[model samples]
Target: MSSKVPLPAGTTLGKSFEYGIDVNLGTYDVPSWQPVRRISGFQPSPTPQTQDAQTYDDLGAPNSDVTGWSINHAFNAQVNRSITTGLYLPEIEAVLARTDPDAKGEYAVLDARWYHKPESGAANPKDAGRGFFTVATTRQNSGPNGEIEVLSITLTGKGPYDKITNPFAGWTVTAPSISSVSASSPGTNPAGTGKQVTITGLNLTGATAVTFKAIAASSFAVVSSTTIVAVLPSDVAGTVAVVVTTPAGVSAAVNYTRAA
Candidate 1:
């Protein structure tokens, strides 16, 4: 959905919507949109009915129509969003206030939490990391008249953020900090095309040269410290590694399979 705020000219968005969660206030919010899945079309306007509780027929009836209902009434458009908050949340209190204003005691509250552990069929954390940080908490009434509703919350740290996103707490990267690496050629195996590859593993910057061990003698070339790009030597095939060295330390050969 759009407001009177017109977007800047020529701004296009990709597929997928994003959401988020906030621990500060123990609330869930929609933070942003990330294209994780492919999409063809969208329903930009779905009648524009509100999600808040009302006195009328169940889900509040349309407040008239969005100017011209006959022209376009549905919100069906591909939105590339990073975060959007204030989503619909059917508050149990709202229902109690409207339906049972005076009723007190012995009532249940419908607060929700971000369930990462099993039994809470939530999306995996790694997959979610690429997406937004959001969740919904709908305080549905404990009684019969309380129907299902939703309120989406997006997490936005109020304070300053680090220049570089540090790894999540209690997590570590396991990729080896190796010494050196090399790539072989698809000498015989037709499966692998002659793919040019860059070997990685050690402090390889300012390297004098990178070469194919058994493939070609002249297949060596100077490269940067962290990585070195090289072509597939003609003689070699299958997996092999390239050696790398610097003033600090020498790296072990990192294996790379050859492509035909």
Candidate 2:
């Protein structure tokens, strides 16, 4: 006898939109990754070049040998143009640059990485692929009345795609940095006992903890990805360290002075 089991309740499946492609805006040596936005119907097509491997002595069926393979990434996107500013999105601008007569070097070739972003938490390295690609863009000129214009963009691989770490690994929570901390009320000595201070730096979103002189802040609020407002706790005087912690990791300590 055999039996079958059904999937458990509340099981979540991956969505097509979870996958993303990021183009390198900077040089390959020092890459600045930015996601290609406003895209729909993304598809990756991999084709293999085959050779005849069948021999006359073969039994039932003929055999084929795979010599090489290549992949073409394609997607459709609505023309992202701002009506007020009359500016196209950065990713769209990059794609348009490729059509220029004088386009060369990096503008001609796009260094890109595509990966699946986890439903929640950090991105896994194994879910990413990186390579250089040539861009092909076709703009739709005519469609049904009142229909929005669309662009068909294809990224033809220059070489093989390589499995690599997710360039946008810490999409959820990147470790925060403290550039400078200033008390709300100036000339305040010993920044503790309900004293509010503004902490500024990069990646301050979703902060889990803020500590002053190794003592946890009484309370904290993440204003943005680059700012945090925290109430200091009681601590002994003389320059102390301030640090922020997030899901990804803890930030390097920045010195804060607390007068004795």
Candidate 3:
């Protein structure tokens, strides 16, 4: 089924695969894996293939082995993740401290999800890429430049990864939150074109970017965890989604408008 939706004229489709989206992990009730720095290694197992041999028969027709045929087989799945230290995540800690742990065993079950919102258009704003997984190993690394020690967790799954519809049932995604955003000019400029804007939110520190409708701000300053100043990019007249991407993950998007 398909439906038509209205959009402002001259509104161009923005780029896809913009990085810095937040990734969360955990179970249905006591969801715990969160505040993750970044994640990767979400891929499917390679398909195993085999072919049958063919030969010419007395009737000059091709004949193939009756038992020889290609078939699909199940394989183990794997995922890699990197997260900050010091928070001491209880979920992962308990799994690591288990008396008996195995990558393929059911001792370390985990669930993961990543949120991506389109900068423009009537995007659902909650497209979550999710999967069921298990932790295989956890490694820690550090550098000499006073960098904080980061822990990397390797995950493996029994079969294929699947999506989760209701992830935030009990616990929330542990990351920065955006409360409000406004233009710094004297009057209300909905378009926000070429105007300095201030965004009020939580966990604005270590913010890597501030975007208007997914268009990155050329210049921005993080005054504090609750405030960020940025110059809005010129864009088509329409409602836009604004968000801040940090090392921890991307913040929930806030709505902004651009006047014609």
Candidate 4:
């Protein structure tokens, strides 16, 4: 049988390769043992469990269990493995070329994932330094008590990204100008819905985001280049600092009184 047959010196059983049994039950996780195959004429419906959107742990995060790193390293270490043998899909040369010209991103590695499952089996799976895989569960072969899925993975990350964007450029980040700021509608009788009121002041153009400094207030919502439309915090009923900032620097606190 194929099970007893010996694979060539450098044989890699792809995730799609059939081994005639539930790989979960089999020693090497053969697709045959999976629900996609065992069950006759079965197809899983797409749902939250199998979201098309994939979520991943941060790279080098505390403990990205993501197993098979060693195998990945070994496969990547080959550096000179033959491509025709299906050893490497994302070649090192192409990897280096597509990288950002920032750090030493010239070198990158690639891995595979399941189409609808990721919660099962090992990710970045490798075999004898010749084959690699990322398994997902599927209903096609899973039994009455089984689960199925496929995982979608991509080659991402070279380093930690700086999540900060500069908002201040040629604009001078001077201390905020005060022109009678307060938290009150036009007037109960004929007042503006304060819900959409505007605050006019100097140095409001470069303020990308704004925050209020009322000890009891929640954070504020920045609405425009210079103005802010914040929900009144339950306890933000008094004067507080209206601080504005830009990528270049922060401005002095401008006091805005909350109407009683």
Candidate 5:
């Protein structure tokens, strides 16, 4: 009998802490999203409203048709107030603004999005939801002896929820790097044709371009977040610097020598 066991098709799994929420603080027209800090718990409840659809003449069990849906996003956070600056966390301030008695218009509601953090060096992160919501804040138990204050915040959905790409793509981006570069045909000199070179590094996904000795490569392709295959310019010779560019920023140059 074979000793090997079958493996699951999907290997990647996510942790609870890898998910997060962001609240928009700026105006509706020009929104700025900031991550909620000091959160201890987060729960999103989606409920469906149903109506009876079964006819008296027929079935054994009554049928219920989904008529509508609603969601409530709630979270518990540790109240963090700065004694020196006398300022609350931006996310906490957003909820406080909605609780004002005279609050009107945009101040009465908040726009928010929840997303799953992507793996490091992902070119495009996905799986996010966004919507407008009404806020409710409640103060939790206070310990007279010694305990930190906590707040429970609930956001009732106002309308439709939208599936979206990562709202804060820049948050995960890091500058690309180049650790080593090597030509595929190391002994063959470029007799008027470009040489194939492989680059290995981190955060190399979505590479816009590659440069050899300050001269652009003939062509290049990002094989993965950590590798790139490029064709060196035919005119380049001797030892030269190589660099990679991506959305986040440019990478530090690594020296490479062409075949003599």
Candidate 6:
């Protein structure tokens, strides 16, 4: 039998180069990760500031009366990526050109998340290096011998990159819940007309209507997904059932007494 030959460099290996980084703008909520072959230029250093002085025999330890010590430097994470793509350059340019007119600032920095997964990994694994970063530099390079061109990007983290867990796995949208309702103000009445009655419940956001018995409120404001403030219809009196209608569904009727 002939001996098998070794594979050449850049050959695909199982579980090799399974590293990825996700870039998110303004938020660390990344939907997915972008795979990268190689990453470099990571140096971690803790610059500590300590206050200590030489103590006489009065102190048990020679170095006594130490005021305090702390890592006085903000972490600056620098990572360089070797991306195998000619098409990625334009995308980076678009991101760098983002301008917020209202804020009057360039939204250049992007949140970056790095992660790795081996074979048989969890369906969705957690990521590393969750923090905001700015693209410090980008350069395009070519192989010495007519190989594929690589896009290089250098990212500088604004602060320390934090390890974060993924909370979106196996997540599902739940229907809103309405626990209770009450008057918004102390002087307001739960069953009084023209007063703002607050519907206290879950998923009260986007409330379409707030009705006392069968009569709709004059006006309603969705304070939050869990609360709705509605003005009771004018000239309506007597005990009535209060209910809220939303896209999810109508909540069970809660009785409200309209103060005569």
Best-fitting candidate, measured by TM-score? 2
Per-candidate Cα lDDT values, in order, are: 0.32, 0.75, 0.53, 0.32, 0.75, 0.51
Predicted structure 3: clash tally: 3
Model 3: what TM-score? 0.37
Q: Provide the lDDT at 80 for model 4.
A: 31
Candidate 5 per-residue lDDT over residues 64-124, each given as its tens digit: 8998776779998887887987878757887888989987866688898887654543323
For model 4, what is the alpha-carbon lDDT of residue 116? Answer: 20
What is candidate 3's CA lDDT for residue 134?
A: 54
Candidate 6 lDDT score at position 116? 49
RMSD of each: 22.8, 11.8, 18.4, 25.3, 14.6, 16.6
lDDT of 4 by residue, 1-260 (tens): 46686779744545432111111111122110111122121221111112132335434434322322221111111133345764322232233333435424222222211122212232232211112222222223235664442212223322221221212132233534435454436653111223322445555654444444513223445455456554444432456555454433344456665543
Cα lDDT of model 6 by residue, 61-105, tens digit:
656353432111121222333376433332343334432233223
- Pull out the clashing pairs in model 5: none
Q: lDDT at 73 for candidate 4?
A: 14
Regions of candidate 1 where Cα sits further than 4 Å from its true position: 1-195, 214-224, 247-249
Q: Cα deviation of 144 in candidate 4 (Å)?
A: 87
Give the Cα-based TM-score of candidate 1 against the true structure: 0.24
All candidates: TM-score:
0.24, 0.59, 0.37, 0.27, 0.57, 0.34
- On the 0 to 100 scale, the lDDT of residue 173 in model 3 is 25
Error of 4 at 6 (Å): 63
Whichever of 4 and 5 has more lDDT, that candidate is 5
Candidate 6 residue 55 Cα shift, in angstroms, is 8.2
Model 1 per-residue lDDT tens digits across residues 1-260: 86678879755443233222111111123111111112122222212333434457646665442332111111111222234544222122222232243434422221211211122233244521211111222332346775433222222222222121211222121222344333333344332334456565545554433434424323334454445655565654566545443322234345555554
Once superposed on the true structure, which residue ranges of model 3 sit more than 4 Å away at CA?
1-174
